[model samples]
Target: MSIPVGDVTGVEFDRNTAFLRHTFLGLFFLLLSLVLTVGIVAAVYLGQVETRTDIAFAGFFGLFAVGGWNVTYGLLSRSNREVIDVYITTEERTHVLCGELADAEFVDACAELVDSDLPTTNRNPKLEAELE
Candidate 1:
């Protein structure tokens, strides 16, 4: 089930910008996350998480708070360059997903691929000039 790195042929992407705005729902998540983060911090400050189980619960709260924070950022950010998907096409004509890379670096590199080989000397995966 392994496609050698050298077998990659092309790259393609999918994007959805619906949540890339400061909408009411987005703001709600932002505010809710603040409360979650504060409660955990307060508990830690008061030494309420001394027990293993209490600490686990605190960690759980912190994880959700972080997830909410990330979603809020995505909603509030107006950057047009954010991409929702990027994947590669192997020489065997099968698609292989490439996780998100820094948008600018990925785009700039893709623009430069310009009909180059699968592994450019720098080994950047070739991507289409534009993400669709």
Candidate 2:
């Protein structure tokens, strides 16, 4: 299937690897909390402790904290910003496109005004004539 081209000038791409942290950390903490809750409840049940309300309340709060952590971690780790790979066009010159024009402009101003001395790599299809 072909990807649809939109009115966007250039598409930025960033992988969703950030979610992996959430998955691993979330599961680990969730399991840990579950085990602890089970142990606590078992102890309370077997010990003939009269503090049934306290044990129940503590277990409920613990589960809520664990569940909340998992949800928040997953959401916060999700990448909202996409990184630009390159500017796609038929233009001859490198456009040096940037998301923040002011930031680029400020850096450009402070940069030494000198022509690039990069040797044209022969592998570049568009610069074949220039390379030759």
Residue range 45-67, candidate 2, lDDT tens digits: 78744587876776676677667
- How many clashes in each structure? 0, 0
Number of the top TM-score candidate: 1
lDDT of each: 0.64, 0.42
TM-score of each: 0.45, 0.32
Residues 1-132, candidate 1: write the lDDT tens digits: 455657776655555344245577679999999999999999999988898999999999999999999988877776433343545667567554332335666555545443555542223223333521
Model 2: CA > 4 A from native? 1-8, 18-23, 52-132
Point out the worst 10-residue segment of candidate 2 by lDDT: 112-121
